[model samples]
Target: MDPTDAFFTQTVVGAPFTVLLGRRRQPGGSQAEGLHINLATGESRLSQLWQEWALLSHATPPGTARTRPGRVRRLMERHALWVAVLGLLSLTGSAVSWGLLLWK
Candidate 1:
């Protein structure tokens, strides 16, 4: 299998499990153990485990499948284009500031 494909699968499936399980173990052990366990389980099983855990953790009452985003998220979603424009403008401003600083 392609290295990229393997990495992407690991990122999507194994990473979350590693993160979740990592919190429970001693700090040094967590990182090593998480990777070892996740890799040993392989992608499919890790994906299933992640999905099951996600569903359990994020469980909402039945029939409430679609919930509205929070205020900040909704604002961002609705004004994504504007946000991008503002971000670009801020970046330009910072670059100009840096140029002026270096020129001095």
Candidate 2:
């Protein structure tokens, strides 16, 4: 699979299981060792994650400003075009210089 597709899948998967956890709330199962081991640690991590998700989810569209990438890409494309042009010009200049030296 493409790296980008994998990245998107991972992004969604890593999103707090809590986002949909409420909808699928199952009755607590038998308290296994894993379940009881770090209740406080898990709760605090979830709490902090939820706060971050809330901030991101609630942020205004204007505040996000995602268009910077397109601008950066255009700049890079322009730079690439200039580099290509410069390479061709230098090659042509070298050819002319070689011809002049041969004529001498």
Candidate 3:
């Protein structure tokens, strides 16, 4: 088996991760498709949905998408702390809102 195919299949099949493939609109009125791999956890899916929307809205070239693993890792590392903080803040805000609503 090809190494690349083996890697993708292993990562996606029955693993704690998923590979999402879809098309996005390009700047010159064309469509660009890309692949995104994300964790299968609930919170990760929610975050990935938002990221997918943003990526689709401003589509990248096919080559860029295919070669984005390193870039994606770097970006996640850079924003990990801020992302965690925001996630905590959102959960706290939601819990507070729910408590207030139930109290009323």
Candidate 4:
């Protein structure tokens, strides 16, 4: 077997599935790579979902979706923080308004 095959195959003799996700070189440049939890079947549901999303997004108009996956992922990560901050500010403003009404 090829040397890289070892990297893709399992070393242990227990679990039926093994997953590996990382960056690797493609024909043009480096791209996301994954060895799914199931190697015998040779299919990753996660990868398929990602592929479908990529295709659907590219089919959309420019600026309608994230320009890049990494940026979009970052935005998603911070989305909750932004929402929480906004909610806190809104609540504070409402409380201040109520206090002004009480003073009047």
Instruction: Say which candidate scores most in lDDT.
Output: 1
TM-score to true structure, per model: 0.42, 0.27, 0.33, 0.27
Per-residue lDDT tens digits for candidate 3, residues 1-104, read: 89898889888874443334443334564332333345575332334445677768666655664544698789888999998999999999999999999999
Ranking of models by TM-score = 1, 3, 2, 4
Q: lDDT at 96 for candidate 1? A: 100
Candidate 2 colliding pairs: none
Q: For residues 28-101, could you state the per-residue lDDT of candidate 2 as single tens digits?
A: 63222112335666642334334565667655564566544588777878799787899999999999999999
Q: Which digits, one per residue and each the tens of the lDDT, describe model 1 over residues 1-104?
A: 79998899888877433245223433565322212244665653334445565667656755777777799998999999999999999999999999999999
Ten-residue stretch with the least lDDT total in model 4: 15-24
Q: Is candidate 1 or 4 superior in lDDT? A: 1
**Per-candidate local distance difference test:** 0.66, 0.61, 0.65, 0.61
RMSD of 2: 17.4
Residue pairs with colliding backbones in model 4 are none
- If the candidates were sorted by their lDDT against the true structure, best first, what order would they fall in? 1, 3, 4, 2
Displacement of the residue 74 alpha carbon in candidate 1, Å: 2.5
